[model samples]
Target: MDTFWKDLEAAAEARDADALTELMRAAAHDGGNGEPLGIRYDAARSARNNVDKYAEN
Candidate 1:
């Protein structure tokens, strides 16, 4: 796989929302499309929600 995908996978595995967001922004910028940005926003939101849910347990 490409480095870009590797980095994304790493961030996801690490649960690093900030890193994921940054990568998504970069991807969206390069692609000139809103899809990546939307994905990034969702990923960050999901990560935060996951953390919050875990904390409630």
Candidate 2:
């Protein structure tokens, strides 16, 4: 894995929720407002599912 992706994977594996959240925000920033990279739910099913709730609230 490239340094960036490797770091991301490492953060996810550590169960570092805040780190993963920051990573998502960074990706969205780098990808720009239009075609931004979305969330990465690498840990659990609830993680994937809670995403929409985040947007809605």
The per-candidate count of clashes, in order, stands at 0, 0
**1-57 in candidate 2: lDDT tens per residue?**
224466566665565556667666566555333433453323322342355456568
lDDT: which candidate is best?
1
Q: Write down the worst ten-residue block by lDDT for model 1.
A: 28-37
**Which lDDT values do the candidates have, in the order given?**
0.60, 0.50
TM-score of 2: 0.49
Give the lDDT of residue 49 in candidate 2: 36
Model 1, span 1-57: residue lDDT tens: 235556766776776767866775666555424354456545545655665566579
- Against the correct fold, how does model 1 do in TM-score? 0.51
